[model samples]
Target: MTTITQTAPLGDRTVRRIGFGAMQLAGPGVFGPPEDPDAARAVLRRAVELGVDHIDTAQVYGPDVVNELIAEALHPYPDGLVLATKVGGARDERGEWVRASRPEQLRATVEQDLRTLRTERIGLVNLRRQVGGPEPDAVPLAEQLGALTDMRDEGKLGLIGLSTVSAGIVEAALEITPIAEVQNAYGIANRTDEPVVDLCREHGIAYVPYYPLGSAFTGGPRALAADPAIASVAAGHGVSASQIALAWLLAHYDRMLLIPGTSSVAHLEENLAVDGIGLDDEDMAALDRVAHLGAPSF
Candidate 1:
């Protein structure tokens, strides 16, 4: 595959913006080792070969599996590649997401990420807040981001970011440190984080949407895949509905960095190829109407 020309500023480096998310490389429910480890490694290697530079993964992914696969596939890590991970949660034996964002937990998680990824310092580390759902371990902003900033000073984290946050939290985190990016659940179908996206755009910070495919939205991925508006736009562009969803995001905002995850290399190429599918004014208008079609606002 040819290199995508579109780029976005991530920290001090500029990346292709259409990056890979390694969450799907893990096993069922994002826990344990994947059934096919060699397949996962191949996918990771293939992604870098296809010009994917920004890879989003977490230590909790497989509780450690995906990071190792990434290290095995691309440990020497090509130049201009940025590996971003999150801290704030871990998985129990049963594979439940357990919030663990205390200062101590943050420190340990950061350390573990460095060890697993075989990097002395991570390119970017996101302080994932336990918001948007009921959780027992919600720490104050100062405690969470403060630990990360300390690590940054110690040269363990290159850039700081926030995940699963609101606009107010983004503003607040700015006061704590220079936030390079914000990863939130945003897509054409879920506008709950619209305000945050606008805030990031206004400040020139990267807005990396995790579920850019709208898989976890109100009506699930089928709702978006089966939508007439998206399908019509896809037909005009001769791309799939999913490509329309990703391209719409790319067209909607200049700073939007997509991290759509997939285990299959074929699917990875398809997701990364969205930059070629352009959306015009009429296509964008039709897609904008999709938000009104039972799309949830949070």
Candidate 2:
């Protein structure tokens, strides 16, 4: 009878491991309002009704559009609901991500999230580093984390996290502040961050994988769709390849948390149903070899 609705400590709060990622709620290219605002609101409400309490977002997502929809749909968030947001990135007029981690900009984005989400204080604020784009900016790590620390001292944030960073950055940030979570791109096919995940697990930090299904670089679910082992496992479990993909992540490590983003109600339900697909030792063994299953070239 166990379900994926299990709760774990995220700093001072406990939230379900399988939380909702609101990035896709934004429009194409993660800019402008969603094509269907009502549908976005319904997904937020439905996630809560399905026992999801952790919701991850960033101010750059729709440049504030998703936050507005979140507030409109589930403001005065239910107790135990952890609202985790990010700063250090902004979208230009063309809907491209730009580095904006200057101290003033970080402060402005944090305050903007407060206003957009209509919350007095944010539960968790992650300082998303900007070093993954085609032309990554040389963001100063000390200055960025310092700004968030000052805000946390002033009670604007409950906990702090880092995104799209390496183990070195994690160690450096730890010296300046306590990181409650680390968001990065990781999955069965993409084991590049395995060391980082191990480091977080050792320190009991939550390793929230942003693109469990794959990111724009990793082929976005296509990475798994073409894998016969995953499909075979899914067939044996009576689940879809996507569910097996998620379950593989959950079974890979205890500290691993999933934030699969989707705009459809049916897809959201399917992603959440990962809790029902229990991977036995054989299944885990098969999935454990996925990293060597001619892992995608991306």
Cand. 2 Cα-lDDT: 0.84
Q: Which stretches of candidate 1 lie over 4 Å from their true place?
A: 1-5, 135-137, 216-220, 291-298
Local accuracy of candidate 1 as per-residue lDDT tens digits, 29-109:
788999999999999999999999999999999999999999999989898889999998877888877787889999999
After superposition of all CA atoms, the RMSD between model 1 and the true structure is 3.0
Provide the overall lDDT of each model, using Cα atoms, as 2-decimal numbers: 0.85, 0.84
lDDT of candidate 2 over 249-293, digit per residue (tens): 887777677888888899899998887677888887777666432
lDDT for residue 164 in candidate 2, whole number 0-100: 81
Best by TM-score: 1
- Ten contiguous residues with the weakest lDDT in model 2: 289-298
- Residue 281 of candidate 2: its Cα lDDT? 81
RMSD of 2: 2.7
TM-score of 1: 0.93
Query: Cα RMSDs of all predictions?
Result: 3.0, 2.7
